[model samples]
Target: MCRIAGIFDPVAENLQQRIEGMRDAMHRGGPDSAGVFVHPQLPLALGHRRLSLIDLSEAGHQPMIDAELTIIFNGEIYNYLELRSTLKHYGHEFRTESDTEVILKAYRQWGVDAFEYFNGMFALALWDERNQQLILARDHAGIKPLYYSTDGKRLYFASEIRAFAHAGKVFEENSKWRSAFLTFGHLPEPITTLKDVVPLQKGTALIIDLPSLHIKEHRFFEWTFNGKLKQEDEAIALMRETLEQAVERHLVSDAPIGLFLSGGIDSSLLTLIASHTRKDNLHTLSIVFTEEAFSEEKYQKLIIEKTGAKHQSFLVTKAIFNQQLDDAMQAMDQPTLDGINTYFISMYAKAYGLKAVLSGLGADELFGGYPSFQQQKKMKLVEKMPESLLRGLQRMPDHRLRKLSYVGLQNSAAEYLSYRGIFTPVSVAALLETTEKEVEDDLQELSAYYPVQGLKNGNRISWLETNFYMQNQLLKDSDFMSMWHGLEIRVPFLDKEVMLMAAAMDPAIKFKKVPPKYPLVKAFENELPEAIWKRKKQGFTFPFEGWLKENEYIRPSNNAEQKLYQQFQQKKLSWGRYWCALLMNRFTPLP
Candidate 1:
């Protein structure tokens, strides 16, 4: 819940100024305190902006160091208490009860292997004075973000891309990333919208040697779904245990916390657990839509009654939606189709005096809670068709079924590109001033980078959804939206231990025959009211269709609107498409 930045140069004249600029840009992330540590030779400088969630004392101040190492860390180590006990065996004296100190001590005792002992979200930079090497690592699931850029002579890193822009690097927009953005709704991970900057991939670590300037990246963790256990009951029980522990650990915060109760199974379960831990009634917040079809107020009301938690709800209207759309887009460090809801929710939480809120973000990805998972199973029949026939099918007219069929013929990565994509290759090309062939070529190039081999069939779709769709789209969106209101969001379901346990369960149990997030629904069956469990997963629907039709800001071309309106009238396209078109129109200036 803090911002960290640093610079590493074997030969640099003034490193302090650069570190100061980076820290200044990240002031919004941490306003409680700020500190800088410059090495004796000025070759390395570490900057930190503290949020003071844990110790709330000057003793928790970081660039925290021991005799061997100095560390600039961002994020929470939920298992710091556990690690502190283990480090005591090695006679490491702690000056404060801070996770930052625990991390420095653990790294000193166990080296890079300390990442394995951590059970929380983090991105840390440890300057090993003894080894004369700098080690950078992200949490197992990438719940927090770390971005870095190197010019061979100097390496600069920060919690946000904006911070890096202040380090005297020209802000050149990356066109290829923009192209990917148009297709995927967000720039996929390992690649940012900036050419020179890159995000450290999830479950990976980097070690940089000071003298040689050589950098080594290692994959410290990987999630696997293949498990030998076959019993559904056993899987449910194990998932319940892991998830409860994850939620309990995430609740370790000094500030007043709440849950973003969506009335969905994931959030419902979180609210229940948080309520159990609180002596007083738990505070639960939810968004209510004016449009009944998109409202979950009834379900949320049911959960509040069942749990006996204090509840607050906000009514979102078209006016609020229109006003916030522009600010939401500008707040994005990377482009994403989601986050509008997250932004509004976080804003509400902040206004209500809540500093932190637990979210149920990763439950969908970890427990097979997307339609794409079940759809991929049905799509498996396409592999049996001849390559020639599949190629011929792509030549068919522009129809929804044909579009879906073409996606089925593609590889897992390409299929994923099509599934979540708003504007298809044909559509984007036709709409843009550029040629369709160019867009297709660009998509192919980007698709090549997708980790297709690691993902196979439904599992492939699941991984792509988790690592790419959820990471780049949902998680990125949530981070900016929540942070914009200065509210820290903790996703308990995304905890490494919980995710690993879920990943190890059989896919059949993870995605039951009933529907998406079936396992989660089944695990908390008794705790949740029957009405809440039986409700269809609406998937965070905003009243986009109603909003678009009401807002005058969105004025589509007569021809386009007529066709789009006709489709809407016939229910050919879900309300989502009209909403996308409306968003594009709202952003587009009149000729």
Candidate 2:
């Protein structure tokens, strides 16, 4: 809901100025208000840009401080009223009816374990003045971002990486992460595109002692799918109840709330539940296409009628795509293969005067709605092939066989990544100056040290989809792109409670073969019409490939990149490969 930045150091003369510079870089994300905090005796400083979502009064102002602790926070804490009541029981008095004050008090009451009680999206930095330590924590799902860098003297952290970059912090593109970007279309969690800068992982926290600079990392929560199996009807009941609760919690805001209706099952279900929960008329937004094949106005209309929601649809023409491309590019905080759709949607929401919106981003990952779910069976078969044969098949001319070779050679995480990635190691190397062996070695090291380690079959695939794809691409894209318009995008499906419920369900129930999101659809069958559930899944994309044929900026100075573009135009390249090449060429500066 806001942008937060800070400097933690033993000695920095102009700490306030540097912190202000970081906050100012992301001024668009929180144009409503700004504040900075610094003490004369302390070298630390914290800066905040407020969007004013929960409490409109200045009482909600951040870098909120007491005698012992000071806090800078971003995103919503939906259950703040409840937490506030609990803290009152503990004899903590609050001056403001704002979540910011609740967090400060909660930290006082529960210490580091306070994170376990928060039931919403957030990335926060707390300076425990008494302990002389700084605590940084991300929400359970990483719906918000927190990036940090340390020079062994000072620690710089912010809501966006560009903040640090703009505040005179130099960020050299790390070669390893650059190569990983070519393969995955995103840098994985804790790995920023820049050297020495790290994104705090979801469900994780870091404590830094101010004087010693000693750091300790803790995993407060980890998503796992291991709850008791239930009868189909019972499971459906649980899913329905959990989803409705999540939607209600996500609706907590002082600002006007809107829903991004993609005309898909996830959005439709949310519309149904939210309409039932909110007393006022719900505003719904959708993107329509002039291209009939790509449009879904009919389904969107169905949801509107069913929910009695006021609907606003935007028609995207080739002209609009051309017009918005530059603005979207400038809005981008990090180079991504996705988020162009989110950028345009956010602009539409902003135009309608909406400050906050709900998206159905994590439903696909949580409920097995992607083609990757179905491909797991084939992967298991490929996994049976001997390593000797896989190595030999790696030399095969047929690309399909070569991809199968990857499945045979690597673990489930690496194999799933190879299946969903932008490029194979060999293909990525051909595009970059790095060799194929170097790319393979980096991938091997990553797989060996994988954080979501030791999960198998469907569970393994789910972890990768949620942790890597959703964390890196979907949620990260949502943050920068929507915040570009000074908008807050909330995901009910990624809510801590909702994620735990979905993760705990038996994988077999979540991944039935007939319709995608089988359990979720059944849970709300009365709420969502069958037509929405039965429709073929289409990706939320602009006419990017069509636009690529005409885009002048897509042309690259690098010969390898140009060749990849040529292959894409000739229809000889994979979609992921073509997009990676286009993005690299568009973003990489010519010397």
Candidate 3:
């Protein structure tokens, strides 16, 4: 829960100005304190902004060093104490009780292998002074962020992209990235909106040798769903045990902690476990929507009664929504269509005097909890058709039946892309001032790089939904939104141990035809209320349609929305068009 930045140059004389500027940009992330470590002989500097979570003492101050290594780290190492004990037995000495020191010492003993031994979310950079090498690494699932750029002579790294702006690196507004943004409502990872910078892929590490200026990226871990347990009962028991341990580990903070209870099964389970583990009465925060279709207050009330935890709820009115929307949009150092909910909720937790909040973000991806996962059987029927026939089907008129036929004809990635896309390729091309060929080219490029495997027609949809949709979009939104408020959001479901176990379970067991996330619901059947178990999954959704329709300040004037609304009023276009227009306007920057 901190911000880290650094500069490495072969020719530059000093890095003091660059380090200070980067630290200043990340002040919001860590308002407690700041530190900088500059290599005495080399033109290298590492900077840190402290959030003061675990150790409140100045001893925890970082750019932490052990004999020959210096480190600038962001994120919690939950297993630090255990790792510390292990290292101490090997004759490693520690000057501070901070996890930062633990990381330094562990690396001293284990080298890059230290990453595998770690069991927490992190994005860290360590400089081995003796070796004259810098090691940069991110956690397996990417709970934290790390961005970097290199010009063959100099390398720069930061926790946030805005830090680069302060480092005097001008970001060119990449129209190619903008094109992808217009289609997907997000600029997918490995590629940021900026042309010069790239996010280090999750589960990967980079080692830069200072003398040679050679950089090598290595994969440390990958999520796999192949390791199934022998027995169903054993799987359930193991899941419960692993989750409780993760909850306990994540609770290791000096500040007050709370749970972001959505009243959904995932959040409810977290609340239940945390209430037992935490000595203090657990504080639960929830958001209720003003829109009837979107509100989940009734469900929240049920959980509050069942758990009897001290509960606080906010009713998000149109006025509050409008204000937050504008603030959130402007908060976008990178554009995102999601995370407005996360931003406001984190803001609420901060106002309530909580520094860390637990969320159940990765459960849907880990377990089979999306509608697309259940639609696997339907997709298999389409895979049986010949390629030529399917190509012919896609050119049919844009009617409801024709749309379904077109969907049936698409390849695995294309079908999954359609599911996650805010606008169809046809619609995006028509709306954009650019040529259709360009948009199609971008889509094809994205499709080729889309990171899902096991592309059999049926379960391949599930694979794509988890890897591409959840990884690139949902998780990215959660990280930025929560960090924006200086609040540390720990997702218990994303704990490595929990994820490995969940991945091992068969899809049939996870998502039965009767109810989605069936195994999870069954495991907690007695613990949860009947209403909660029976209720349909109401995802975290904003009332974008209603908001656009009623907004008076920013009325549509001969624009896409206005034209679409006119068609709706004239009984030509349906409500779906209005929804599409609103999404298009939100994602596409106005002239």
Measured over all alpha carbons after superposition, the RMSD of each candidate to the real structure, in angstroms, is 3.7, 2.1, 3.2
lDDT tens digits by residue: candidate 2, 1-591: 899998876757667788898999999899889999886676778899999888889888887888888898998999899999999998999888889899999889888899989998899999898888899999888889999888777788899877876555566876676677777787776566677888887888899997677889978887777857557778878889888888999998888899999888898889989999763679999999887888889999998987889889988888888888888888877767899999999999999889999999999888888888778877777778788887666566555566666665454347656467666677677767678889887777666435666666667777878877888888889999999999999999988888888778887788886677988888877777889999999778777767666777666567777676777667767666666766765663210
* Separate clash counts for every candidate: 0, 0, 0
Structural similarity to truth (TM-score) of each candidate: 0.90, 0.95, 0.91
Model 2 residue 307 CA deviation in Å: 1.2
**Number of the top-ranking candidate, with TM-score as the measure:** 2
Q: lDDT of all the models against the reference? A: 0.76, 0.82, 0.74
User: Where is model 1 poorest over a 10-residue stretch in terms of lDDT?
Assistant: 582-591
Is 1 or 2 the stronger prediction by TM-score?
Answer: 2
Taking the tens digit of each residue's C-alpha lDDT, what string does model 1 give over 100-184? 9988888878788888888888888888877788888998888888988887877888888878766765656565664556566
Model 3 lDDT on a 0 to 1 scale: 0.74
| lDDT tens digits by residue: candidate 3, 60-153 | 8887776788888889999999999999999998877788888888888888878888888899999998888999999988888898888788
Pairs that collide in candidate 3 are none
Q: Which consecutive 10 residues in model 2 have the weakest lDDT in total?
A: 582-591
- Candidates 1 and 2 compared: the better one by lDDT is 2
Off by over 4 Å in 1: 9-14, 279-281, 381-412, 431-438, 446-449, 454-457, 548-591
